[model samples]
Target: MNLVKLSELLEVSRSAVTQSVRRLIKKDLVSFEFAQDNEKKYI
Candidate 1:
């Protein structure tokens, strides 16, 4: 999900969500597909 939506669901700041997502991306724990607007749902 987008950072804004995720932040709301998580009750956290958007910046915090952004940082967390960034870290996950770096660690290859998260990914996205712009074409399908997919989210990071690790398997």
Candidate 2:
């Protein structure tokens, strides 16, 4: 899901989700890609 959806689902701020995703990315646990509209999609 994208950061907005993830944050809404988790009831957290977008910044919080972004930070977590960043950490997960550094650990190679998660990754993200840009959509056609340039939105980031977490995978």
Candidate 3:
């Protein structure tokens, strides 16, 4: 899901979701990609 959706579902701020994603990325646990259909990034 995208950051916005994730934040909404988790009831957290987008910044919080971003920080978590960054940590996961550092550990190679998750990665994000740009959607060709839109400018949004997905995890």
lDDT of 1 by residue, 1-41 (tens): 56677888999998898888889889999885453556543
Better candidate by TM-score, 1 or 2: 2
Please state the error at residue 19 of candidate 3 in Å: 0.4
Off by over 4 Å in 3: none
Deviation of model 1 at 9, angstroms:
0.2
Write the residue-wise lDDT of candidate 2 on 1-43 in tens digits.
7889999999999999999999999999998877887666756
TM-score, predicted candidate 1 vs. hidden true structure? 0.70
Q: Candidate 2 has what TM-score?
A: 0.80
Clashing pairs in 3: none
Stretches of model 1 off by over 4 angstroms after superposition? 35-43
Lowest-sum lDDT 10-residue window in model 2: 34-43
lDDT at position 39, candidate 1: 53
Question: What are the per-residue Cα lDDT tens digits for candidate 3 across 1-43?
Answer: 8899999999999999999999999999999999999989999
Clashing pairs in 1: none
RMSD of 3: 0.6
